[model samples]
Target chain A: MTQQPTAAMLAIGDELLSGRTKDKNIGYLADAMTLAAIELKEVRIVADDQEAIVEAVNALRARYTYVFTSGGIGGTHDDITADSVSAAFGLPCIYNDEAIKRLAENYARRGIEFNESRRRMARMPEGAALIDNPVSTAPGFVIGNVHVMAGVPQVFQAMLANVIPTLQGGVAIISEAIDCPFGEGDIGTELAAIQKAHPHTSIGSYPRFSDKGFNTQLVVRARERALVDAAAIDIRAMIAALQG
Target chain B: MTQQPTAAMLAIGDELLSGRTKDKNIGYLADAMTLAAIELKEVRIVADDQEAIVEAVNALRARYTYVFTSGGIGGTHDDITADSVSAAFGLPCIYNDEAIKRLAENYARRGIEFNESRRRMARMPEGAALIDNPVSTAPGFVIGNVHVMAGVPQVFQAMLANVIPTLQGGVAIISEAIDCPFGEGDIGTELAAIQKAHPHTSIGSYPRFSDKGFNTQLVVRARERALVDAAAIDIRAMIAALQG
Candidate 1:
């Protein structure tokens, strides 16, 4: 891991790709990752296919410090994330006894059937640890660097909250946002020079077009506050000169 | 290439990964792709780095029938999607004469300077065709099967609308949503049986929990209406039987 622990998110589902469910998890996870001092490097939204899930999980887990996946952990036929993740790690998917006990007790209390279908929630890769889901009885599993969580937003959030406390985070990135009166075109060259000067700092320009014409938001980010502030100062100066 | 045209989205920007800017393009494009009779298979959000962009562009372009990219095509330091995409295709990113002409004319009408920075908007891969941008007049370009569009929602929409008409679309996928009174656990086994029975149709179960407890939405999707309808009927029957 670098100064900031890098992470890749795999948001798996068919509904997201089909436009049936607009993903609400990626942004939420991204925000949470930012707060935890994790550098979210990539996000891949793949289908519910086991092959797709396994392939993505293998690729992401190897590349990043942490790989977080949300979706397909339910008690349905399409919920193959656990099995796929197990396959990715070359482990057999098995019914975790602790997970099964919890699910069984919860279902019993709720007067629900603890049948094979519901029991699917207890499935995990062999030797994987569990991330407790307060909202749902089904526990998410952590195998190696990858953490597999629920597709439901509420459950995913709850599991994430549980996972955060256990993490030994890296340096938190500090940032500053400067609103530029001019468009990106007016300051692109100067912005490029500023970026070259601060190689370690990330400077991003966001342009918005409306009735007021184009105005850009310059965001400077770095592991240290002084680095971000310095870049922000340079960006503000560049914008001020361009406004002249 | 299949019955339904397949597409993969490459959302390029560092802001999205950093959680500084929530992505608005993926959902919009997913909806648009659905409407255009195209099946969106995968979505990858990568940073503004040239290497990441190039790698993702190459991977998605080869796998899907069409690869659509949004963001990082702006005239800013972080905006390197055009150059990266050109590199992916082994082509030189050149400033197109027609694009330059349009930008120059638009800027002249608005009494704005057509400076070197603004001229960066005219950059595209050699031998690429242009996609008209009705919003800001910065043209998107198409090289091979990849369509590069703006990051801005309005501009991306306009370019997509323009691109849709030009495409030879595949079979339109039809779908039906059946509201299940029971949770996924209650009907998972029967639903799986139904899904197994219908090989052509895709059956997905989505569960929601509130004060009312768990309720699932079963969506059936296929190339033809009959295939989707058949699976939906089976799902409805399973839900009704479970309810009784």
Candidate 2:
């Protein structure tokens, strides 16, 4: 039997840590992965330090089928993602001849000087393939199972859009929700029982306070369409019988 | 000398791991902590499993000055954060009389049935103090340094707003950046020199592709305004001399 494709996301930036920036990348990529049927199993947010990036990449890559890393790929002093990824795999950092050629061409068209620092973007881990960045010329790359993308949301999303299409996917997961006016304790035991009976289905309850009263949101999820529907049916019935 | 207040973020949800949801809570809380002058040192995201939450809470709380958790505190079957935190410290889950009273009264105004499931939101750890949730009636709570908050962004933000103003903060960290038109290797040595010169400041070198070609973005960060400004100036001057 073929194993399900699993992914891990590593978000790197000190700005994220200091709360200077809100990371929108994780959710965007997560939704993208879900749409593509790639299961995102884990996410880690690490500082933009070389040691941390290297360690995280090495660890996550070995554990998951695919690893998607965002941030720290820019031309900033805080951007050390590429070098760290290379070091993590003991690969040499070298300029991708094709990337450099394209970058130089793009710069020429834009009438921008392909300065030394700007030219540095073409450098990537040896043997890695470039993931195109349409929003900007800075190309994201794939080294082994790790896909290193840009940090800026626009460029990152563009790169990811290009990268995800190339990968294989599994059955797309779907979800549904039912609002229950009852408290969680009234149904916690039964819900746990339902979960145990249907191990494949993912069930969750979210409680919110509305002007009418505090309401509980029971969410059901599954990779199989039938199972999700069945779970929702059972869940709605349980809530109705117990509360209504 | 006074030690800085530190905080860690704990995001609890299977939705996060499933990639169905992107976490805004951590980034939001991190920003709030920074604004309050607290140092956010670490963040951990665990699935909505009891053991996972308990283990994470126990481990993180001991290391950081405070642990703020979001998600899984709702009134759903998946909402086990309160119990998990309580279990971690061997505390019992009990309905807060005050919470139950308030919840009942609040629901009465709306003419909604205060079902048993909804009452679960009123459950608190034996000694937990409720953190006011202005956006919603289901209050967040604080036990020692661990603050349990709602997962919904608006509610979470409001809940955090209620808590942040009361916490102690330290000097706000600041940053500055300069673009260098050089490859990472070309300036690696000089960059090392800068890092050594400003040990208190964090210097990051990111290599990226720009319209001008590959450029490096060098960022210097420090808590002291004067030091950060000085480092930025020196960094720019060094890059200038390197390019020249």
Candidate number with greatest lDDT: 1
TM-score of chain A, cand. 2: 0.94
Best by TM-score: 1
Candidates in order have lDDT scores of: 0.86, 0.79
> Which of the CAPRI classes, incorrect, acceptable, medium or high, describes model 1?
acceptable
| Chain B TM-score in each of the candidates | 0.95, 0.70
Q: Which segments of model 1 are wrong by more than 4 Å?
A: A172-244, B1-3
- Count steric clashes of candidate 1: 0
Question: Candidate 1: fnat, from 0 to 1?
Answer: 0.79
Task: Indicate the TM-score of model 2.
Answer: 0.73
Residues A205-227 of candidate 2 have per-residue lDDT tens digits of 76554434346677788878899
Candidate 1 per-residue lDDT, tens place, B118-208, comes to: 9999999999999999999999999999999998889999999899888767777788888888888888998899989999988889997
DockQ, cand. 1: 0.33
Give the DockQ (C-alpha) for candidate 2.
0.24
